[model samples]
Target chain A: MKNTLWKALGILILVYVFAMTMLVPLGPGLLEFQDVNQVIESTREGRAVPEFQVIGFGTHWDQLPDSLQVFVQSKGQLAALEVIRVDDATHATVGLTLPYSLPAKSWNVLTNHPVDGTLLLENGLFLSDRFIDAKATWPAPSFIEHSSQLGLHFPYQPRIVETIRNLMLHVPLWFTMFLLMGIGFVASIKQLSNPRNQRDDDRAVASVQVGIWFGVLGLLTGSLWARFTWGAWWVDDPQLNGALVTVLVYSGYMVLRQAVDDERLRARLAAAYNLFAFVILVILLMVLPRFSESLHPGKGGNPGFNSYDLDSALRAVFYPAVIGWMLLGTWMYLVTLRMKRVNRQIELLP
Target chain B: MQGLAFLLGLESTAIAFAALLSVLSAISSRAGAGFGLTAVLGLPLIIPIVLISTRYGTDILNGILWIDTAHHLLFLGALTGGIGTLGFILFPYLWRD
Candidate 1:
């Protein structure tokens, strides 16, 4: 018992490590920043619109350096460029490109030259197109003329926020399900080979019950994800449809075992059905979703993580979560098996 | 099930009837009491995975378009198979008559 306890503790530590590595790093990978909503209220009515300060590490600023270089090449502004140092990074005031005559307020302190009457920020960071119209008179005709350059990337990166937490959901259910199904598979194979062993039959049935539980879980989790990712509670995508059918099929396997009264016949028939269903599960889950367009990973044409994506950080916790859950599940199965044996013994008492 | 549907194409209309028939066969075999007991005992096992699979599916998707529908389904199937199987194996006596 001491040795067993130590081994169990070791296994648990390994699992915790695994989950931490997989689930935690996902948060940083999908990191995104939000636009700082500065309150630019009109302090003094109309002498000048209050100048806004870009705050909260604005996301679209990365595009500015290239735009600045283009302006330099085009002779857009002869004004001397000055770099403002903020936290060891050089930030351009956009006012540097103006011809000294335009006040910082005129172009909203644009680091690039004013064109028409408006100023262009990095990657069309400026929300309005009228700014582009205003900056047309600036020397850089090439920069202000394009429409595509003006579109800013969307402000919020919800994918980063939502996807990192998914490790807890999608991966664990698969782990639990696989653990239960393996038992079912083992029990069925054992009973088929040894028909007289009621123990094997009991074990097989218990495995099926647990499997059905995981299957339902997989569906519920998938549905919740669908709402966020696909914006629907359910969709007819091949993957979604396939999973639904697979769960439904397995549920049938469970119900069949319960309805049959003859112990011998029930075991045999249920075992056969379990085998068939598992095979179909493999094909449905493994084979068919690959052939067409699917809104899921590991399918052709959909973007997914490559080998590099499963970095050391993710692998660390992920492997453990898998093992921990698998062990916990197995422990539960064994306890049930023991109880069943005891009950059977009690029933047999004369 | 596109697997069945893909194999049969539009012919799945025929298979659906058979699938329904199988469901009835299963229902008649299992006790309703057994089913309810399984549900009651299984809630804790089921709820967490339900929550986890969704969260992980999104994380795995992570703006990479390389993965398609089949992958998602397989991930889910593997998850269900793994966790549910573990539960069954771990708690066999729970189903004892």
Candidate 2:
């Protein structure tokens, strides 16, 4: 009954992890930026900034407020105008720009370029003017107000937007892998201290099995992310190659364990190799490559950590992702240990 | 059997719903599947729906379509729900002798 309960809990936890990963809105959706022609016609009677209306999925023609006037009347040719509306509850904002050109009885309909027509409520949702806490008015020139000599504007890459969510999955896999391997290292060290204790040997073996799984998951998620972000499944990056080498060394530990038949001798030698492999793994994965230029984080030439990456929404989902996956990994280890015990019980029955 | 197709379809739908509920559970508990299953199921459902809506959704939104968007959502929901429930029901039996 207790075993079944644990198994049930494990399944529930596994399902939960998969669930959060999907439903969490942590990445960019269909983004559209179009040059809207808002024309203000003046025939010497008076100058009026012409009001323009755009009709689309969320905010159709009917949703337009009768109280709110269409155009911001300006004296001079408006170089850049931005309207920011912040939602009081979620604190998310939508900024729309007023582009050049508007004439009498002229209306435009601009749909999001890559419209996500998901049945999900978030897909076609639009920011209503009512829910806004405050609106910040800024000129286009204000964007470059900070710097004049150097202005860096990253190209709008779709892959970068999609791959941003991968930070939760791939990075956590490595973190969990490191953590598992660290446990293995400690267990191996303990076994080295007391060569007589079989429990230490079993623990060390279990850690390696769990650690290897995490490493494999890391590689798979990383490769998938690489395929999307870098346009290739395998890239010749320093960090990528180093991680592969680290995983391979750990794999060798498994092979070495199987080669030896004597249990005592196998445990002693495998534990020693595990300790060695772990040190090398840390150096390869976390230390050496970080100093050099690499595409992967923690080992890259990029100095900034949170700049343009690790947005608030992504962070909210990411921390939990790490915790959930790590817990799941630990759960798998427990199950494997139980299965091993069951095998021994059946073995003794004969 | 008619029941089998309905059962499979229902299981798929249940798995889909379970995927959603599981996500909410993860959020509250800070542990579990996280968001993998929803994403997998979402891809097939969301992509087609989003594509159909964004490009052709204007007509649907304007109420010109023969079938409402709700119906489509229902079909998808039912299909996923059915399948997910079927899977849950079969889990115990799967390991049984």
Candidate 3:
């Protein structure tokens, strides 16, 4: 058991990661403002804006109501929201009494609490375009010191508030797949050069079989993440298509193995196919996805992991998760290789 | 115009498709692999070429010039080259046994 120290380390790291992934609370973020029914008539003339129920995640508005400063800021214009009442830490009511002279309707919400620091939401409120061109000089910016909250909390993103936790779960699977397939590719190349030693073929097949398992997991987890974030189980994105195609190509390798009758011939043929398939896999997954327009994060024009999306707190856990998954995949591949070798031995006994 | 684009696509498709078919048939006939196994192996490889060429054809029909379709054209060419080269190197090994 002590000989398999890395396997035990992988188990330990995975257990630690599972705990960290769920335990780390996300930072304060603005939820939607309750919609108001009172529509303003063309002008702010004699009309009063309704009190908006402000909702936030992990914000302490109730306890720090006195120090709570809410403002709708855009360009050079600014209008601080009047906190009429504090319902709870996550709920509050703020008067939307705009500065009658303020001309901007497209603005952002900024709230500063002594404890939680400043939470900002982009494109928070839009009064209407009617007042956008209104001839009025707005209030100057009230430059206040925005302090950072002291604690380990994941950075809150707009649409991916809580589901950002999926980064730890979904991305590591693919990275592990890439690593395993790469190992398989090297083994296949070695087998092709030295067909006399058939052990390399077993090693290649074991690595790929385990690799394919991880790839499938990556796809399913990616689909679920897409459903939560992109509002669909599947989309015709280039990265997605590339990944699906890569998996299918490898699956074809399995069928290729079944088609061949002789054991020696099977090993040689399978090695050749694996060599071709791995090159195609790299091109499809890595090269092609980068060139094409894709809906996946960090792709063409899609709002994905912005500058602050992959935060330091996420990296602390995310990097460990990736290494852990890779170790586990390697462990699985070794076990598969051992099992295949044992089966071959049993067949030879007869 | 679409017909011309499609005809060009059909020709290119035939070349790449033929390459795939030849590779699969050579290996299968050598081993007496069934039709299902041959197809199961071939489609995954051929589909990407078909996918790329279909896009190229669509672009041409949408009034994109032959010169403007350089990226797709070069890509299709590159895929064909990669396929041909892989088969050239690998087939010799299969021919031995």
Per-residue C-alpha lDDT of model 1 across residues A127-226, encoded as one tens digit per residue: 3222333243344333343222332121122343344445555666666876787788778777766777677888977776776777788788778877
Range of the 10 consecutive residues with the lowest summed lDDT in candidate 3 chain A: A38-47
TM-score of 3: 0.88
DockQ of the two-chain complex in candidate 3: 0.56
Residue range with the least summed lDDT across 10 consecutive positions in model 3 chain B: B1-10
Model 2 error, position A50 (Å)? 20
Who is ahead in TM-score, 1 or 2? 1
Using DockQ as the yardstick, the better of models 2 and 3 is: 3
The local distance difference test score of model 3 is 0.79
The TM-score leader among the candidates is 3
What are the TM-scores, per candidate, against the unseen true structure?
Answer: 0.54, 0.51, 0.88
Highest lDDT against the true fold, candidate: 3
Error of 1 at B80 (Å): 24
